[model samples]
Structures are given as structure tokens and as C-alpha cells.
Target chain A: MSDSVPAASQSNRGDDFDRRDAAWYVDRLVHLLVFLGGVSAILFILGIFVFITREGLGYLTASFSPSEFFGSIEWRPTSDTKPTYGILALLTGTAAVSGLAMVVAIPFSLGAAIFIGELSEGKTREILKVLVEMLAAIPSVVWGFIGLSIMNPFIIDAFDVPVGLNVLNAGLILGLMAAPIMTTIAEDALKAVPDHYREAAEAMGATRWQVIFRVVLPTAKNGLVAAVLLGVGRAFGETMAVLMASGHSVNMPTSPFDSVRALTATIAAELGETAHGSEHYRVLFTIGIFLFLITFCINLIADLIVRGIRKK
Target chain B: MTMKIAIETHDLSFWYGDFQALFDVNLSIKHGRITSLIGPSGCGKSTLLRSINRINERIGNARSTGQILIHGHDILAPEVELLQVRKEVGMVFQRPNPLPLSIRDNVLFGYRLHHGKRGLKSSERDRIVEKALSKVLLWDSVKDRLDHTATQLSLEEQQKLCIARLLPVQPEVLLMDEPCSALDPSATEAVEELVWDLRDQFTIVLVTHNMAQARRASDECIFMLLGKVIEHSETGEMFVNPSCQETADYIEGRYG
Candidate 1:
């Protein structure tokens, strides 16, 4: 019986069995490629952070004053006599516009998300999702143009304000811009909740509305909050649209009709005019750093909230 | 004593988008007894169990032509309210799925749904929670941690809590689709014992893949194959003197 055993099997043992074939080499190559692809994202983010800090470091250390930067509204970067670098007006501008944008966007985005994720079915859900994504795909520049041409005239005509471009115009435009992405993220959050939770709740005789309000909402609350925070981040970082529709004036916006300059708008409007390595240029970069930090902190909080849900 | 019918299905046929699962399934389950539905996989046992409470409709394109009577009322009728049907017939899934809430809230969820949250004193809610937990024999281990999340419990405890949450609504028929399948042997034995204890209070329709569990835990046994009922008899009679060749073949471990 031992002699009858195949000679090919005996010959192929040990060294031959351990041989790496073409497929093995290909698999290793693909693994290395994927690993590099994953690492590149982190590398690019770090590179951007380093570049921004290097450009802004001079202003942060030497000429930066806590009271002038945060406590006053004077932001005359090109003044021949003692340029003022205060950003209080710009900070309030961003805050007022983004806060108002959130007030306008939250209801529309969350309602659309619930409809898409929980209520609609089959083709209707698919079509609505595609439409919302298409809304997000519209260029930010085009949104700024609309704020300039359409909402500019409409706000003046309707609200009877002096200038068409102000916090109201910028806020309405930014809210519309932010709603689509918020809807998408909120919908994903609602979808991430297991279908088993819905099944269990429905089996317990919960009405459709009751299941959404009581069970699904509570379970997905963290993700929903993260979605809203991401929307806030987007509103804060937006520059071109806010610049166009906010009338590009530096002031503490006391009402929706008052024109104001956002932090991002200040950097965008001044960086090109300033000579390289000058205090003006560095101050613009300093504003860039501040914007970066605010967005980073918002995103970190959103991530932690999402991670809290995963731990449970 | 005359047997009271808790559930009766007349010529029930179901389809999942033209692929029929249950074909002309007729059954009469007695009240206040445990009836175990035993069959191999893909024999439509779970389908039948889910159909009792009309939960099968949750799957889009699932349709049925049947008359399901519970306590002499045709629950399949268009006029029948789904919430009312679900309140009368509760279900437990193969895997335990506790809501992401406190154990106390999970126990009170159904009660609050049926009886509005308002007008209920804290003492009354606590009493309801304690009684339901005690019925499932879980109060002793978890009495002190009532505010803890229900999803944090062990598998056996979660399954017990799943069953306990159904009691506050006072469901007459409890449908269990392989409740112990996710548990280890010892947990299975404990859950089986709990089911046996519940037979005196609720009419339980248990769908199990484990033949030994059907023999040990149920009063009546049903053997099904290819969506057809092969045998329905007392547990002892079915094991010893099965009337159908298929039932004998199945019980004797000849073939599934």
C-alpha cells in the first residue's frame, strides 16, 4: 500500500510545497499598495497642518497680542500706521452666520433624513437619496454666485433691508448649502442603527411614529448630534459664499440685516494683496490657524460622540 | 376537559414574492400549553411562527392568503389593527435583542406603549417591573442594577429579559423562534426550564431545531417538512408511535 501511494505527492513535499507562486507575490504586492493608500490620507493631513503652522508661527509668537486678537474688532491689516490685527468682528460674523445657518438647516436636514432612512421605501428612497446627493454636488462657487445674484436681490425685496448682502443673505445661502450634506450624514446615522432594533420595537406594538421618536431616535442620538456638529464645521469653514453675501464689511453683527466679515472671509480677501513673509501675510495665516483649530476641535468632538455609541 | 383553541390557521399559504414558503398549512394550537414546532432548516417553521403576529409583513413583497384566528377573531382581516394584534401575540427572536435602554425602561416599554406614560406612579411602575422580572426568574440577579443598560447583560439574562418584557402587556400567545439556539448547553437548559414554567400562563408556540428540546420541554409536538405538517401529537406519543412515515423517519434520526 505504501508503494502504491502516488510518487508525485512524495516528490512535491517539503521544499516544493513551501514555494511561493505568482499569486502569492501578487497578493503581497496588493497588500503593500493598500497599506500605502491608507497611510497617504494621514500623511497629507499632517503635511497641511505643518505647512499652515510654519507660515503662521511668526505672527503667533512675536506680534500676536491676546487682547488685540480677540477683544477688539479692528482688523486693518494694510494700514500704514500700526496695522491692527483684531478679529472680534470676524469671530462674531462667523458665529452669527453659522449659528443662524444651523437654526435654518437642522429641521430641514433631520426631517429629510428621517423620511429617507425610516419612512420611504424602495424606489422613492433611492430617488430621494440621489437628489440629496446631487444637491451636495453643486459647486460652492455657484452657491456664492446665487447668494450674490438671487438671494441678494430677494432678501432686499422681501425683508426691505438697506443692503441685499448681509448676515441674512449669507446665512440663508449657507444653510441651503449645508443641508444636503447634513441630510446625507444624518441618514447614514439613522441607517447605522440595526434593523433588529426596529423589528424588536415594532413587535412590541409600538406605532410607527412611536418607534421613531422613542426607540430609533434615542439609539441614534449620538450620530445625529455628530451630523449637526459636522454641519456647524462646514458653515464655519465656508469662505467664498460668506464673503460674497456678507457684504465683506468688518462689524459686530447686531442683527440679521447688518453686514459682517467672517474669519475665513478676512483671510481670503487679504492674503493675495499682502507681500510674502510680511506681518499682514502672517496674520492672514494666523487666522487660517485659528480656523483650522476650531474645525479640528469640532470634528474631534463629533468623532468622540460617534465612538461612544460604538463602545456601547 | 374540552380543549380551548388559542390559535387556528385555515388553509394558510404564504409567499415571499412568488416563492411560496408555507403551503396550505392548517393548525390548531391549544390554550395554556407549549406546542413545539420541529423541523429541519428551510421547512417554514420560523415563517409560521412569525406569521402568527403578522410580522412577516415587515419584509417588503411578502404576502399571504390565509385566515388566522386568535380567540375566534380573524387577525388577518384588513380591518384588524396591527398594534392590537401585536399586543395580543408577542414574539421572541432566535437571538436576544434588548433595546438600548435601561433594564427598567425595557421592562416598562410595552406598558408605556399600551398604557400612556402619564398617570402612572413610580411605585406602580416599579411593582410592574419587579413582578415581570420575578416571573422570568431574573429579579434576584439583576434587582439592584435596574438602571443599567439592558444590552450589557449576559446572553441568558438578556433572553430572560426579552421574555420578561412581553409579560407587562399581557400577551395571550407567546411565539418563540428557537429562543435557546444562541445559548450554551447550560443556558439552553435554564431557558427551557423557564419556558416550561411559563406554559401554565401563556400559550407558547416554540419553533426549535433541537429535537431533544421539543421532546423535553413541550406538551404537544409538531413535525413539519417542505412547508407541510407531517405529524401533530402529544410529545410522548409522537416520540414513541408516530403515525406518519416521515415523522418516524425524522424522530428515529433516519433522515431530516
Candidate 2:
């Protein structure tokens, strides 16, 4: 009986071993999951990059005349006579369009973000924020459609342009589409600033505009820069909006009125017609590789900028 | 040490929406003197300092009864531009808030706004910035890399930079809300010494919950409780002789 009592007590103690408090257990699980999941996702993403690079980078290394892909300037693969797939044209177009979009989007988005985050009143600020959020929820295809219908007429008539499907239209639409995401992220970053900063600036006899432009914006610059880089990435990867807005002729567009085809749109447009494993298909994949590299570089830059700001 | 009255709050009362934050608090801020507002937290010490410069207006539906006179001009008057009011009355906060710009930019931000590009030549601007830093005693440490980002400064230096930024504008009154609350002992000492130095050029309303800080820094004391001015006197008189039992009990540490 004494032996039984001791043995039962030991078994009961063992039963209580992993039975932690509910709140404590939940807290521990959440931390564990978050840490594990975050690392695993990063690893999985990195593995995808390695996979794509290994498969797709081979064509890039092929003779152009051994290295025609990166070194060539031409992009017409539909025509015969061993069509050249040099990505210089598509790349130039991407750079131009993305740059223009950023120029339009960054300022307006930053302004909207600041205005929405800093200035507007209780209900008005909330409403504006919600409205901007709704804009983000609108599908990319709907934005493309909207650009074709209303935007086409508005720009064609207002600017006296023959066709609205020019770089200007594409950039304008892209800016509009990108604004919501940009403004939301930027606003979140700006809102993250402590109230004490604004109070300090105001106390320093800084005007409202001064407080905003000088103190708030500068202080939150890392997040603000991240927001802008994110917007540029969106503009680069966007297919339908650019496809509908940018006139898709293979020839290089010199003016805003002239139709431009971004690399993304070109891939989407010609992929079906091109025979699989053909040089054109390989070129499209090669453009994909280019895109992957560019986005990767931008993400790296954004991270570096954030880290730099943090160190300061 | 003899100086004019830099600011006077006459029966100033502030309300956040329907909730009153301060009531009928009359006080005078002497130039080149630090007047500390001491009370328990949430006792309207910070609120009263903020209302002095009409900062409460930034809040939605904030209103005030009574007037704030910065050199006799009623800030509450409609004709007075708030921007100008802020310029005349500068503030320092508990936490050091330096802009995320180069040390030079953070110091001259106020100057640049008021002066614009035409106001000061780059060389002149540098001199002014240097002078302002020297006033706060941060020049020697930060002088080598004036163009480096402001965040690189230590906490004490950052708060000093905030002070330097205000020096450029040369505001008549300076309002400080717990300026040394977030600092270590040495940093707090640095701020305290600078406050004593700056009082010659500016009227200061220094707010703190620490009674010792009030005694150390202030010439006059305003004691607040439940959003009302419970007592106001010269620091010596208020500390040595008590008028109200409540004040006596509070000073005796009955309850915060």
C-alpha cells in the first residue's frame, strides 16, 4: 500500500508535466509558429529563386550568336530569319514606364499618405483611409478595364491625342492603380511615428506644413522609401493594366502618344502563339529571368535602405 | 537675472471635447527663468503647457476659455496667425525627437522654413547652426560630421539638438513637457544645465512630476491637481510654507 501511494503520486506529477497554463501555452505556441513559419517561408522562397535561376539561366548563357539573349537589342521573335530576342528594347521600355509611374505615383501617394495619416479629422480620415483601402481591393483586371473605357476617352479628348494607349496613359493608370497600395503602406509607416515627434516639432514653433514635410516625413523616411520601392515593383510586374494602356506594337515608342509594350505585357501577349521550347519561348522565360533579377535587386535595395535608416 | 515677463497665461482653461483638462490657471513666465509645473501624471501639467502655445487646437474639437499672452498679444485672438504664435513659442518634449535628416538639417529646419533659401547663405547657415549647437553644448561632439544623420547622436545629444533647433528661431517662450523624463542622470544634468543657460534668452515652462526637479530648475512653481491650479508661488515659498492642506499632504507624500 505504501509502494502504491508513492507510485501513484509520481504518476500524477508526471501527468502535470506538459499541462501548462492556457495563456502561457498559447503564447509559447504563437512564438514558436511565427518563428518557424517565417524562416521556412523565406527558405522556400529562396529555393524557388535557385530553381528558376538553374532552369532559366541556361538560355541566357547560350550563344547570342552564343549570348544573343542579353547582348541583343532586337525583340521581334514572330518574324522568320532567326528572329533576335535581345531584351534591350523591352528593358528600356520597362525602365521608362516604371520611372514615369514612380514619378507620378510617389509624390501623390506620399501626399495622400501624409494627408490621410496626419491631417484629416476623425471620421473624415477614417473614411478616406477606408476608401483608399477599397481601391486596393479592386482587381487589377477591373483597373485595366476602367483604363480602356473611361480613361481612354478622358485622356484622348483632354490632351488632344489621337490614341490614348500611349506611355502617358499607361503610366497614369499605373500610378492610379499603384497609389492605393503605395499610400496605404506609406500611411501605415507615417502613422507609426510617435505623437511626441509631431508635438516636439510643433513645440519648436514649426508650422503645420513644416512639421509634416520636415519632421514627420524625414523621420519616417525608411518606411516611406520602402513604400515607394514597393510601388515601383508593382508597376514593373503589372501585366493587364500596362497591356491595355500601353499600345502593344513591337516598334519602339518615342512619344507619350506612341504605344509602348512593357516586358511583362509582351510575354503575356506572344506566349500562346510561340511554339513551346522554341527560341521565342526561351526568350520569354529569359525575360522572366530578367524580371526575377530586377525584383530581387529592388527588394535587396529596399532592405539595405531600411537597414541604413535604422543604423542612422 | 532681471528680465521681463516672457509669457502670461491668464485664467487659462482647456477642454478636450467636453472633458476639461485645465481650469482658471493664472501664471506668469519670467524671461531667462525656468518656471516648472509639477504635479502627478494626468494632472493637466502637460496640457496646460500645450495650451500656452495653442497646440491643443490640433486635436479635434479642442477648445479653450481664457487667454494666453505671448508678450501681451492674445494668442486666442482670431487676427493672430497660429503659425506665428508657434514661432514665438517653442517647445521641448520628454523624448528626444530629432528629424531623420543630417544633424545640420535637423538644427536649421526652423530657420530654413522661416528664412527660406534666400535667408542665410550656406556658410552663414553653418555658423548659426554651430552657434545653436554650442548653446546646447552639443557642437564639439557633433561638429566633425555636421552632415551625418541626426539619429546617430546619443539620446542626450538628440534632445540637445531639438533644443538647438529651437534656438535658431529664437522664440520668446519655451515650453518643456518632462524634458528629462526619458534621460539618464548625466543626460538629465546636461539638459538641466542648458535650461539654466537658455533662460536668459527664452521664457521656459518646464513640466515634471519630480518635486526635486522643480526645486532645482524653477524660479516659480505651479502645482496642479485634477486639472486645476491647486497652488502657485515662488519655488522657495511653495516648498517651505504650504497654503493648502491638500498641498501639504501632497508634498508630504500622502498620495500622488
- Best prediction by lDDT: 1
Worst 10 residues of 1 chain A by lDDT: A6-15
**Cα interface RMSD of each candidate:** 0.6, 2.0
Compute the lDDT of residue B51 as modeled in candidate 1: 94
Residue B232, model 1, lDDT? 90
User: How do the residues A1-312 of candidate 1 rate in per-residue lDDT, one tens digit apiece?
Assistant: 989876776655676777899999999999999999999999999999999999999999997898999998998887888889899999999999999999999999999999999999999999999999999999888889999999988988998987989999899889999999999999989998998888988998998899999999999999999999999999999999999989989999899999999999888888888899999899889889899999999999999998987886
Q: Write the per-residue lDDT of candidate 1 for residues B109-134, one digit (tens) a residue.
A: 98899999899999999999999999
Real contacts recovered, all predictions: 0.74, 0.74
Question: What lDDT score goes with residue A280 in model 1?
Answer: 89
The number of clashing residue pairs in model 1 is: 0
lDDT of every model, 2 decimals: 0.93, 0.82
Q: After superposition, how far is residue B17 of candidate 2 from its true place, in Å?
A: 1.4
Candidate 1 i-RMS (Å)?
Answer: 0.6
> Please, what are the lDDT tens digits per residue for candidate 2 over residues A1-312?
675564455546667677768899899999999999999999998998776666555566674353455556677687666677777667666767777888899889999998999888789999999999999888888878877888888889999988887788788888888899999989988887778777766765677787887778877888899889888888889898888877766546677777777899988998888776776777677777778888878878877877775564
lDDT of 2 at A162: 85
